[model samples]
Target: MTTEMSGADILIQALNDQGVEVVFGYPGGAVLPIYDALFNQQRIKHILVRQEGGAAHAAEGYARSTGKPGVVLVTSGPGATNAITGIADAMMDSIPMVVITGQVGTPLIGSDAFQECDTVGITRHVTKHNYLVKDPAKLGDIIHEAFHIATSGRPGPVVIDLPKDVQVATAPYRRTNTSALPHRGYKPAIKGDLTAIEQAIELLSKAERPMIYTGGGIINSGPAASMVLRELVKLTGAPVTSTLMGLGALPASSPQWLGMLGMHGTYEANMAMNQCDVMLCLGARFDDRVTGRLDAFSPHSKKIHVDIDRGSINKIVRVDVPIIGDVGRVLEDMVKLWKAREYQPRDLKPWWNTIKTWRDRNCLAYPASVESGEIVPQHAIRKLWEATHRQQPIITTEVGQHQMWAAQHFDFESPNKWLTSGGLGTMGYGLPAAIGAQLGNPKALVIDIAGEASIQMNIQEMGTATQYRLPVKVFILNNEYMGMVRQWQDLTYGGRYSSSYSDSLPDFVRLAEAYGWKGIRIERPDQLEQGIADMLAHDGPVMVDCMVAKMANCFPMIPSGASHTDMILDPAQVSGVMDDEAKALV
Candidate 1:
């Protein structure tokens, strides 16, 4: 059964064995053989991106949406260099991605050879791990290991640098398929810590006011643990709060949901964290953004940190009970123990009522425009949600005020349903990501809620969506400025408003039209619902330019590096500021 094959063929075979149905990449001289071999492989589809960076981001988007390792293939030198930003973006966000780049032949590695760069060294800091394939025989093993490493242990990008000679070298090929991967430095905790779990349960049973703070780890660990957390909350009657990464884990409208708790979080959620006696931190990190003024953060609460990574426990805030294990496994064990012990806390209705009163008094406040002539960003998101409510669509966003508005206003009913650039805060992320997500779930409705400034970063991907004819609806919140930074300056920095305007902005409708795609512009509020409906009804790619107020700001503001409890409900005052009418003119 031994058959000789080139490194490129082995690589393609490995990918096919891994169930990879698609790849995003660009062709170059060193990588021509790989692309040539890819031509016959009908099982895998290759998406040629306009830029190498777009390829990388598109791969990341595919991975994030599909829960599989996204693969990117690019050439050496400038091609590899162009992909660095996207690699770093994936690394910062902890997304599972594999980047395969062509390198100069082995002999030319250090001879100042043309199109030769130390891609492995350049990407070391960003990737979870990397490899240089000197031997064609080892290509399959390297690819298999890369997928395992990228998808496991917190999930991140992994790189494989392939030399041109190696791609042409011939070797016997054999596919390896298994449930486990061999990595010496990579080991994830899968078993729960029984002693710590029992202690955590005991603490919750004894506490008068208890709350669960969760994060994205819950989503990555899958829905089993998330369900357990919900059941435990219902059984114990403990209020639940989540960070931005953890929003979709608990239903937004649930009675026990206390809203997002951190900077820019609801006042009641922050107050609950400060006032609660016990905080059961599940699959969440004590990020500075979430725990502002750490010295004063949850000062009254006894924190029980449950995380899969041992290092994450006590990395920031100290923990009374540190349980190290997979979030899903730990939650399952805790649930079993709770059922056996039959432990329950007394009535929390009084405490829940108090929290509700605070929430009702000061809901996430946004000014209602009396003019009502133009379409607002919030209204666009609301209508989009309405249009896709029955389908339970997956919403992704680029990083900006529109992203924040979507986070605050969109009611996410399921876990992992909302994908965005959270930790990395990468701009130009939405469009390609939506395309990837649409590819992942062809039957589901996938939309990218993007801003004018952020959308331009990856607008070239419009062709990618069109080529695939992916039914990805792009709702461009065209405010004609970097809305978030501008909002800060207008409020805190004397309204300087430097470099935030796009006076010469391109007409997005026409820009989209240039790509031979359907484009619509919504100027008035009345056109909102119909526009969204029209987009949903269409069969192919479309972009809707939603003209929103340029000066609108994301509310329930928490100033940077400030305590969560010390949030500013209103915009900061500017000295000698003009009245609303006068400010509108500026």
Candidate 2:
């Protein structure tokens, strides 16, 4: 007794089977049938976003925070095109996401029908995988396949283009029960070779200056991976430094912890990477940002790269040991192997001495707020962490100076707490992402630490927060400039300023109020702590606009194309004409 159902019904049912609790999307002409089907569905909830781009980023936020594939539903043409940025961001950072777009009818696709574009063709490059559904009966299987491709292996966004006529047509819904579509071709390696594991351990056992470099792969592998990572770090007593995406994979309070290692990374971490005898790279690609000068990066180290993707190995920096498998599974095996031998902590006293010497520089230290009597952006971020009592809070940030400061100042002690646009560096990603995080964890204190200019990119999503009563806090470091752009001009372009100034900014307090939310403005250092606390304590959405120092720049920067050893440790001054306060606004 097979039941007949529309393509939309099968698609929605498949989503229910996959356990997608919520979807973020915008309604348009082609998607009307699916939206209609969605209205009566009790198993899934849909969040109607103001823009399609917000839908994609919100899904990213949901995926990162929940360890599940964030689902997106949008219409064809501009709606699908708007999601391109997030799709690319997820692909680069490896976040699991499924985007289903309603396309023009199959017959109308080539005819330039209303609200029609090549959704598959345009998104083909950005997505991990894409499908253009030609047959109505295949909708259910395609829906399930999208989830499968999005969440498996190195997770990323997958798109499905559903033609309007097919969505409205009848299907048997055969994919509803136990028989799932077999995907025999996409088996990712989950276990590494025993010999390789043994060899890796031998290197760990003998190395004096061993360091662990990790990235977003550990987080994408789930909390279990982080557990094994902590155990492995403990077993060897080696220094651990994470890339920007790997912040919460290791506890920030551990004695073995060096701060993040990269271009804007802590000096101690970068120096340790440059000098380590053996480097165990786990679940992290050697990104250009992390490797300042590829040839010079970790020149003294014999590197072991452990990643699930075999293609990622030796793609940038050649590795001495390449172990391809799921990071969690590999880490579990390593921990078990080490415990079987009853290994004691390695002798790291000398290594610790050198690290301590570098830490003595206090490279991460910004001017004291009380000393400067000014609200530096880093100081504000440090205060934000302090106000939260250094607890693991769900923190998201837009790209640029605020993102780096959030990464540097906030100490994340657990996985899945720090979310940001890591690889693509998308602006306007924070606020919507925070909304998704809040949606995932209703009771958690979710904050989007955004810069003033970047927040405007998807600022319209504030209404969504208010409508849902999500209790999201948008904490703006209102430096009145695009700080990173200004930093570059000061460093490379003779400080010309060149259209970086973000002038004619709106009154954020009024804007929040207009969106039916609470708003607070903090203009001085003394007002910050309480202001942030107030925003978090509010039962509903609140946006706090903190007036930050306009001229402040993020330091410990690896200048473009320079080695990690050659860092701009302090603010570079521009003499004569461009020295005025007006010249360097971002």
Backbone clash count, each prediction separately = 0, 1
lDDT of 2 by residue, 1-586 (tens): 6888998888898888888999999999999999999999788989989999999999999999999999999999999999899888999999999999999988888898888999889999899899999887777878887788888888999999999998899968865442355577777788987788878888887899999999999999999999999999988999999999999999899988899989899999999999999999999999988998776898888888889998899898999989999899998988898889776656889999999999998988888776436698898998899888454689999989999999998999999999999999999999999999989988788999999999999999998998888888999998888888987787767777888899999999999999998999998888887898788778898899999888898988887766778776777422323333323331
Which sections of candidate 1 miss by over 4 Å? Answer: 177-181, 369-372, 572-586
**Which regions in candidate 2 have their CA more than 4 angstroms from the true location?**
176-180, 370-372, 572-586
| TM-scores of all candidate predictions against the true structure | 0.94, 0.96
TM value for model 1:
0.94
**Residue lDDT tens for model 1, 208-300:** 889899888887777776788788877888989998778778888788887887766788888899889999998888887688767778888
- Reference-based lDDT, each prediction: 0.83, 0.89
Worst 10 residues of 1 by lDDT: 573-582
